[model samples]
Target chain A: MAVPSFLARERIVAKPGFNRWLIPPAALAVHLSIGQAYATSVYKVALVEHFNASLTEIGIIFSLAIVMLGVSAALFGTWVDKNGPRAAMATAAVFWSAGFIVGSLGIFTNQLWLVYLGYGVLGGIGLGIGYISPVSTLIKWFPDRPGLATGMAIMGFGGGAMVASPLSRQLMNWYDDDYTGAAGEVASGNSVGFLFLTLGLVYLVFMLFGAFIVRVPAADWRPHGFDPATVKQKSLVTTENVSANNAIKTPQFWLLWTVLFCNVTAGIGILEQAAPMIQDFFREGGTSAVAAAAAAGFVGLLSLFNMAGRFVWSSTSDYIGRKPIYMVYLGVGIVLYIGLATIGSSAVWLFVALAAVIISFYGGGFATVPAYLRDLFGTYQVGAIHGRLLTAWAAAGIAGPLIINGILDMQGEPGNLVASDYRPALFIMVGILAVGFVANLLIKPVAEKYFEPKPTDVPEAASTTGDRSLTR
Target chain B: MSTARTDDRGPQEGSKGLVAFAWTLVGIPLVYGLYNTVKAASALFTG
Candidate 1:
């Protein structure tokens, strides 16, 4: 198969005095767009009614996309490393947008399979590729502040849903103004199909900009005055590089994976049931429940903390060290989960504040892991390493929801439930956080044997500025 | 005394303005999202 010229890997001709800071926005462009996947719930009901399918059947689209995200990231991590961000990002741009386009066709035809193949399979692969493409590049550009750099890019993924949700809702309203019924319960396949077309094209443009605008740091790049030796002063942070395939062989990899899995599973315990949990906690035996919209607002509030934590907690890790940050996430996470279980209904403020912070740690866990990987493995294939670790996320997604929802199911229905109903799930989350805490405690430096041999050193600024010529 | 090729060395000067621009990519949408979400929350909860 002949690879299109656009998809072909071409060396980025680095120019002296060209800004290294430009890279994060390029990352944000793709991340923010892929973040739309989080907002698919906005259209979930419409699709169900339109396709005349069960909720479980429609839910498979998001499930399959997330499953593919883990699979494709693991499968394509090395490809991303070899082809560079440009090629990987371009491929993601094509797949993500095409997924939506194909999904639109499915909606038009009312063929559920096309929607599955388009949004689920193709879009999921895009999510996987797009997710990791910029990680190593950001780490390379901001060698001194890998946590902050990667956090900014990853934070945008959280923010992307924030943008997409309202925008999608408004777009649906605009296109389907003729319909008069309650929100999210009504149907407008045509409006949704058009919305997909709009989203597909818009995402395509944004991702292309990301691919084209992104440039990798040269072989021997570092920020001005950053001493490579300084990182050695910190225990467990290494200057050595490890290939992604080799990284998993070491104990550090699995430890970090456990850390991610536990943190995510605990966070999802709150997230999967955010709205209902709030109502349940405050309901006082279902006498006066927290309104559905307020519950939604609560989810929105958690998302803010989540996004903010990605930037704030990860940036703090730059100063406090990544391990210590994980300690906070795991240790404090246990406390918060316990508090929510114990005194959650005591006061609304306390409940909201505790949940928000827990959610922050959840987002922090995600944004910090890439930097954590870079510290252990070096930037050579940190993106690839991060990709492999994301399987932990996919695993957590299933486990967290199953445990919480399964427990909830053991109780009666959602609206009628009280705080006591969710108490078991909350206490169980404490155990889950405790496991992550142990994993964080267990994480130490990678064994030296797993590291790749060092490449020959190159002096910074040996290269000239304004060199635009491509070499493959 | 460097034998490493010129092309291998990365950019020398950092651009602050561009950094500010990059932050805006996150900042603008975040602020807007927060506003919208707050509005939605208030309307949903208040009346």
Candidate 2:
């Protein structure tokens, strides 16, 4: 059957000029603020000092927050679709701001539950709502360039940490003197609490700007001079729209979930403990405390590559198919992990460069998946489906940290843990990536049995084009 | 309504100038916002 003309055209309804530019910054406003989650490492030292908590205890807060991000997104995604982006974004601003405020109270009172409540529960909800707010809308706006548009927003999520990591470090220094611990000591709790409040307020204002500027395109919008046939030339591209409910029923959803879960798990294993891991790895070689801090900067530098990869590599997925790009991520990732395991600590830069590439793939997996879904299911409730898929991220978030820290704790030896100690965790990441690689190979064009065409009573333009076919 | 329709003309030569002016107004803030963010980070790091 020939596709409708409206489906073939670009989906955005705005007049040419300012509106196109407006979409990305609005997305950045939300993504950049939430991206602070990446900078949680900066606060770890202070948290450990304040609570006298074990590494496991501190890691729980991040794991809990990530889990909540998936849950809340799954529950609220339908609401985001039903209401306009404005309402959803506005609500996200409120909840996210409140999370910081509550977290501040938790710190003031020295109550850990309140801290969890503020940052984990409330902040996580904010992360969920804020995350989906831009994704579906941007795809709708730039259906012709789904990868680029989504990448623009997702890159902000990756880069948000780059900005936050440095800024948080500076703020901790300013609020409390003794930014660097003399002789490898961690910072204090009070200093950490103050930093949280400052970030919360700044993010509040920035997210509000995003919420204010966000608007849905007029109903009949399409990109000028777009041709659907041009888009259909790629093998992975499809013109069908699948609802979130139907999408979950397919084998493809589960397969893609595995891919994402493995990708994130591998990256977070390094990310969660970058500072200590590097210190341990390089300690025997006379790597000073200054060297560790510089290594932490290298973590931030990896974030730069992570952020750029989200835009650059994922955008490339538009030309090459999603499957091929994913093969690169998994194939190269396996080799990199093996290199770290086998090479030992003799060459630090090799490990760093490989880790940097792997992290980029982790970030790119997130950015490109939405377009991948658009190819399979069309735009029909992709935001909701994407939210559902995020559950994989939540699962991976917990699993990743557990595997990394658990193995380390079990080893029970400190100070320059040899390559031998890390072999188990490294092997686990490789095995997980291999499973995801197989799953990617298994995905086929979504079968028609899974889709239910839009009801005829609905407006033709609104309903027929609901699936975001413009993305293909 | 009739007079208004008669007077209505397609985008004229002046329309191009108006479009340019609008872009300038929007583009300035976008560029400056990015510059300011970088400047803030550099100042914090160096100082």
> What CA root-mean-square deviation does each model show from the true structure?
4.2, 7.2
Superposed model 1: Cα runs more than 4 Å off: A1-10, A179-187, A457-472, B1-30, B43-47
Over the stretch A408-448, how does candidate 1's per-residue lDDT look in tens digits?
Answer: 99998867888888999989989988988998898888888
DockQ of 1: 0.33
Task: Please list the C-alpha lDDT of all candidates, in the order they appear.
Answer: 0.84, 0.73
Error of 2 at A285 (Å): 8.2
lDDT of each residue in A195-270, candidate 2, tens digit only: 8889888888888767666655544345655566777777757766677889999999898999988888998897
Instruction: Provide the clashing-pair count of each candidate structure.
Output: 3, 6
DockQ of each: 0.33, 0.08
Full-model lDDT, candidate 1: 0.84
Q: How close is candidate 1 to the true structure, as a TM-score?
A: 0.92
Candidate 2 Cα errors over 4 Å, as ranges:
A1-18, A48-58, A177-191, A279-290, A344-346, A410-412, A455-472, B1-47
Q: Ten residues in a row with the worst lDDT in model 1 chain A?
A: A463-472
Say which candidate scores most in DockQ.
1
